[model samples]
Target: MSKLGIKDIAARSGVSPATVSRTLRNPELVNKDTRKKVMKAVRESGYTPNRFGSSLRTQQSGNIVVMMPDITNQVNAGIIRAIEVEAQKTGYSVLLGDTQGQEARERHYAQMVSSGQADGILLYTHRLPFDLDNLTANLPPLVNGNESIEVEGLNKVMVDNVQGAKDGVNHLVALGHRRIAAVLGDNNAPSNRERLQGFQQALQQAGIEPDEQYLVQGDYTTESGMKAMEALLKLRKRPTAVFCFNDDMAIGAMSVLREYGYAIPGDISIMGFDDIRYASLMNPPLTTIHQPLEEIGQASMRLLLAQLSGKNSAPQHIQLPLQLVVRQSTGPAPESD
Candidate 1:
């Protein structure tokens, strides 16, 4: 009576050890009568399967690490919730890693998967934390969520950022706004680059040349938005409308406009991306792009699950739809005083 093992449970249930192992590892493969007997024996024996030992032997931890560049971003909260819920449904757990845009932290979290502490990874950063060459030798299952970083053999679940930004900017262009300003996220980020491209594309389609003075680079923070707006306001030819890369930046710019005694959509219109919870509750409701964040999260986790189960031989990419949500914050270009 030193310790209980699978052989003890198999002996008590009158089944082979393999059958007992299969029953515990995958109950669906075993028939009902056999499964019930094995479970009954397991209950009677008070034998809890050693998860760590099983993982060590099988090389599967049943845990996925979700790495986010910025945990404080409100938009990421929905994605995390969806991932956690879906993972729990499949008898898996989630380990959250907030890299805070640091290369060392991202690499450290990726190492956990290679070390068997996690079976897979879900990345929200613009680039992979670890080297591609090292990962190729023993590729642990990896999925990209929300942000798209082009990799040769990685699945990505995201909204079309370029199209979403184009739609938001087109809405302003249709309102006769030729002098539109842009508050951009990290200039070096792929997502921001795609969005800026869309902004310029939309203006070009409408026969308006993009003015460099109206383009302000931000860090996707409210404080950056405020400073960018202040610089735009000082321009001799102020923009009649402004588009912020994210809701927090848009809200910050709006606050600055208010402090300057400027009325929203009357003196200058404003719009943003990522229709966050606070968008609709703003003073004049924010116009923005709606991304299915929860769906993006769920799809990424499901892709990783498929990879872990050997259901996918090649990478799978999914692009969710985006919509232009028109609220009161955006309107026609104001007349010059």
Candidate 2:
């Protein structure tokens, strides 16, 4: 049999082809009785509209670009999987853009928005890939994942970084660790700053003074963690427990701690944030704060889909919950040496 088309559907539904087209473009434009007849005929006829032609009329590529600051990091793996799954359910595909912390690469991916290569953008970084200020018009639909930035017109899905950090530090303090150290991420990152504030709050509540010497700067990299651990180890009074900004850095610190003949949680306790996959499989099993990675990804895509469907207005921000997973890596403070 020959392929069925919109005209055949219109004939069977007893309506003009123009009405059928209007129903497909905007269902609200057609009355309820006409829509029911058109859809019933559509089901019986099994007519599939030409996607390319629809895109030409709609100016939507049905593609979303997901920009990751670091593609190799395990923290992004679960989130990316969730985003892809949700996008597929809505008849959309994802283009993974790994910016690798390079401004130039981010700008390149941002070009896809204006070039009609992507319908929307999901950013895992805190900053925009392009300079929207350069244009007088509004930017394309943008949804931020994990990182929360307060832009004029953007949506964000994130965890409570400050409270999560406080929970981790409070856990350490409850275990009798008065001298605790923090391995921090970049000072400029908003998330890092919030986490640091939580750490300080926990210390103050416990009547422990925040030691400048115990604060080590890291870039959320394993190498930075290792170097920071070295400085912490050289201090006259090493921290009884150390809280790292991320799991990668905590793992790096663990390696150096072992090299220095310190047993985890026995000689010194360790805690990490963003409990990645390896957190549970570590030698002593890392104690850490868990960010809802999959949920964040799902929410980001949901917001983007709403924007594309003309249902989204005004800026929205979603802050997900965080939990602390206690494992063998953290223990009570050891006897004073």
TM-scores of the models, in the order given: 0.91, 0.86
lDDT of candidate 2 at residue 75, scale 0 to 100: 75
Instruction: Write the residue-wise lDDT of candidate 1 on 198-277 in tens digits.
Output: 88898888899879999999989999999999999999989999999989999999999999999999999999999998
Off by over 4 Å in 1: 1-19, 26-34, 41-47, 132-138
Q: How many residue-pair clashes does candidate 2 contain? A: 0
Q: Write one digit per residue (lDDT tens) for candidate 2, span 1-337.
A: 6877788889999999889988987899999999999999998878888777677877998999999988788878888899999999999999999998789989888888888889999998878776667542577888987777667667888889999999999999999999999999976677888899999998998899889999999989988989999899999998999999999999999999888889999989999999999999998899999988889889999999999898858878889989999999999999866
Q: What is the lDDT of residue 41 in candidate 2?
A: 94
TM-score of 2: 0.86
User: Least accurate stretch of 10 residues (summed lDDT) in model 2?
Assistant: 129-138
